[model samples]
Target: MSDKPNLEEVTSFDKSKLKKTETQEKNPLPSKETIEQEKQAGSS
Candidate 1:
C-alpha cells in the first residue's frame, strides 16, 4: 500500500482532536564555565 492516505481519509480527519505539546530541551549544551574547565584540563 502507499504511504500517503487517500483523499477521502484526509477530508474525514478530525483536526480539532489533535493535541499540542510543550517545547522541551532534551539535551542542553554545557555552560561556559564547564567548557572552559574542559579546555584547561585538556591543555594541561
Candidate 2:
C-alpha cells in the first residue's frame, strides 16, 4: 500500500486564510474604471 495521505478523505480544510492571503497578494478590490463600467452595464 502507498504511504501518501488520502486526499478524498480530508474534508475539514479551512480555505479562508489561503483565499484571503491570495486576495491580499493581488488587489482586494476592482479598479475604479472596472467598477464604473460594471455599474453602467447594470443600469442599462
Candidate 3:
C-alpha cells in the first residue's frame, strides 16, 4: 500500500546509463545434478 514507483515508469527508464561492474557470487547455488541427487537421497 506504500507509494512505490510504477513498474511501467521504472521499465521505461534507460538501464544502459547505469554503471557496469564485474562481480562474482560469494555463494553460488547447487547444480541441477547435485539438486536431483539430494532430492533422491531425501525421498529414499
Candidate 4:
C-alpha cells in the first residue's frame, strides 16, 4: 500500500444557489368587516 492516504473529492458550493427567490407580489390586508366576521366565526 502507498504511504499517502486516499482523499475524497470536494464540491464547490455556490452562494447564489443557496439564496431563496423572493416573491414580488404583496398580499393586501383583510378588510375591517372580514376581520370581525373571522372573530365571530372562531368564537361561536
- Which segments of candidate 1 are over 4 A away from where they belong? 1-24
Candidate 4 ranges beyond 4 A from true positions = 1-25
TM-score of each: 0.44, 0.38, 0.42, 0.41
* 1 or 2, greater by TM-score: 1
- Candidate 1 lDDT over 1-44, as tens digits, reads 99976799788999889898899999999999999999999999
Stronger candidate by TM-score (3 vs 4): 3
lDDT, candidates in the order shown: 0.94, 0.77, 0.92, 0.78
Candidate 3, residue 25: the lDDT equals: 100
Per residue, candidate 4 scores C-alpha lDDT tens digits across 1-44 of 99976554324546676768887758888999999999999999
Model 4: clashing residue pairs? none
Worst-scoring 10-residue span by lDDT in model 4: 5-14
Which model is ahead, 1 or 3, in terms of lDDT? 1
Winning candidate number (TM-score): 1
What ranking emerges by TM-score with the best candidate at the front? 1, 3, 4, 2
Off by over 4 Å in 2: 1-27
lDDT for predicted candidate 2 compared with the true structure: 0.77
Write down the worst ten-residue block by lDDT for model 1: 4-13
Tell me the TM-score of model 1: 0.44
Model 3, residue 23: what's the lDDT?
A: 98
